[model samples]
Target: MGNQTEVTEFIILGLSNDPQLQIFLFLVFLLVYLITLLSNLVIMVVIRADPHLHTPMYFFLSHLSFVDICYASTVEPKMLVHFLAEHKTISVNSCIAQMFFILQLATTEIFILSAMAYDRYTAICDPLRYMERMSKEICVQLVSGAWAIGFFHALLNTVFALKLHFCGPSQINHFSCELPPLLQLSCTESLTNQVVLLTSAVIFASSSFLLTLISYIHIISTVLRIHSAEGRRKVFSTCSSHLIVVGLFYLTGFLQYTKPSSVSSVVLDEMFSIQYSILTPMLNPIIYSLKNKEVKTAVGKMFQKFKFLK
Candidate 1:
């Protein structure tokens, strides 16, 4: 293929066209973005302040919250701007950067969730050795490893994406800069890019998902061995939030990215991406806070402290 480089920027045809709907979506997403930031910040602050939450589980949860905040920040702010901006255009470099960060943070989140599942498994299945197993040092390494892996994974994808040459029809039919939408705008042959995307998605997503699934299998097996219903309930409560989060994250991600490229619909891809990237971050902190008693107590204590300070 000969060089056909011409387009320098992309026009993002965002979620809606009507003025009323644009304003409405802008407000709705603005509110959601703020709440996501506040909730995740609260989770992190409360976890750090409360001594009782200094365990490996809360440590992982705090990191998870941080990742959620980053994930939402990467996509939502740009989307909000697009909702109102007349140009709705982003430079190629800027678009690639957005996609890179989104992929990095999202990949980190999945790895972190897998770590959280392991933590739960250690807590419930081998309570006596939980501390011995998941020490502070180990927790730091795990979280760091997740971030590092995500970084490199994203780097690989971004490197491949960089090879794609965008020449014309630079209008992306999506709210944010994502791989699928961006690829559609590329004039260059995207065989290598698509192969890399599919390969990395399978490796990263499948491995983390399998780890989480295996951990949950052991967790369920351990929970069943307990004779008392209360004991089972307690154990289940500890993991139910994580399970729900995992399910939502994986389901939407799989539906969005794992489809055959020939059959992908831009509209459907955008909607599914919204579920995982936009809604999942907001839902995670709420789910954990609601389902976990310790988190609720920590939140209550933090609120009381704020009131006293006021």
Candidate 2:
């Protein structure tokens, strides 16, 4: 902490400057926020209520949905307010707090995804050990480790980001208080900031991506070697949706910040951020519930119970 200046607030450049577009954007985001909350709530409820869903996968699924809800809630409501009002300003403290939660939840999400992949790998590759290995204690340990890692990673990132000197204009180019957008406002020589940001990013983001990749590689190889086409098809469907989600998220995220920030286009930058922040949250629930027969069956059973109670 060199010279802690009195930078009190920052203005967020949300989705649009156009007045007409602002209202429209607000409505869309509001709808998205509501749906995200409801869907995640439903997921958590169903997982908690249903005995058939008391598996490690659904346990992780419930947590994953909860994390996405947390993730979207951290960023989207602020953006929605910016669209609704004139003041898009965030206090320095508010910005720092937002970044901390964002980092914690986002990193937690990565680990959860990787854990799910590992779950899939074991269920497929070592079916017999799936029950033995992913026991209640092991599940608790894995989830605990994910939360601990997220907390520490976010702690380091927030600490490092707080040290940066924001001598330039306090207007962040993006909606949220993310590291990339916040770094754009710093006036000092930001070499160390950049390095630290990149390293933290790789630690949380890349590690999960690499694990997903390796798990999928083994999955595909084993699937291909199966003698029956029906066997291959059946296994493929079980993992395909997750594969799609992991691929889309990691690719967009990697392209967005992994390269030189100076070289990336503002339009592309905004697009990638929006895609990752808004769209991906919506997609997570859909990807799991839509094509998954087990989820669909569970949903139907839930509906039937409600109707009978009425």
Candidate 3:
């Protein structure tokens, strides 16, 4: 990959072909994006205004909302625009930048999920010591660790992308600069890139998934040990949202990346990617917050306060 081979820009063949479908998809995705933004923003505002929501659980919840805001924002807006556009193409640098941010937030979401799991772990497995254990200092550390993990994932992935020499067909048959789509457009041999990326993804994904799984297992076990059905329900209620979220995130993501790179159906790939990326992120703030009585109560209180101030 010399200067001559270095790609200055990339072309993105966005979502679909039919103009009618483009308008329809655009409206649908636009609605999804706005709701995602609004929902996440409401979560943040509610969390900040309510002193009771300033605890460890709400602390993690707030961050999860923030992450979902960013995670969904990164792709959906562009995707909406791409739907209605004729020449659905993105510059090479822009594509790379998009890829970087998407991967970063995605990786961050993984670790953040792990941190949330740990919070549940402490809340259930070590109830008496929960507050003392998951203090402010620990919260900061967990958030920091999440960012660090995401950065490294993005950094390595970017390096691999940079190493890839794009010498031929410049059109990316997807809406954004996703890993598989980007790799497909590269002219040079990408054996090394594939190997490195696959290994990294497996290790990171496996470790994070296992950690979350173990945390859930411990939480469920503790719930079972509690004699009262209501006691078990109380504990389960706190963690059930997180379990649903993590399951959706990991499973859809795994479906996108774990497949052999040689599989080249752009439509199928883009469809799966959209599910994991846009739909999943948008779902988090809505699903996680709506399903929980605590968050609903917090939001209701915050809304009442807002009305009083008005």
Q: Candidate 2 has which clashing residue pairs, if any? A: none
TM match of model 1 to true structure: 0.97
Which candidate tops lDDT? Answer: 1
Cα lDDT computed for each candidate against the true fold: 0.91, 0.83, 0.82
- Model 3 CA RMSD to the hidden true structure, in angstroms: 2.0
Per-residue alpha-carbon lDDT of candidate 3 for residues 115-213, written as tens digits (9 for 90 to 100): 899988998899899989999999989988988998898889889898777766787788777887887778788777777778878888889999998
Model 3, residue 38: displacement in angstroms?
A: 0.4
- When superposed on Cα atoms, how far off is each prediction in RMSD? 1.2, 1.9, 2.0
TM-score of 2: 0.95
The C-alpha local distance difference test score for the whole of candidate 1 amounts to: 0.91
- Candidates 1 and 3 compared: the better one by TM-score is 1
What TM-score goes with each of the models? 0.97, 0.95, 0.94
lDDT of 1 at 207: 96
Give the Cα RMSD of candidate 2.
1.9
Q: Per-residue lDDT tens digits of candidate 2, residues 1-310?
A: 3565656899888778999999998888899889888887887888888899999989989988988888899989889889977888998889989988877887787788888898899889889889998987888788888888889978987887887777558888888887778877777766787787788888778888888889988898889889999999999899987887777677787677677876876677888877777788878888889868988888888889999999
- Candidate 1 lDDT, 1-310, residue by residue in tens: 4667678899999988898999999999999999999999999999999999999999999999999999999999989998898889999999999999988998999999999999998988888999889998999999999999899988998998988888888899988898988888888799888888888889999999999999999999988899999999988988899999999999889767778977787778887988999999999999999998899998999899899999
Return the TM-score for candidate 3, rounded to 2 decimals: 0.94
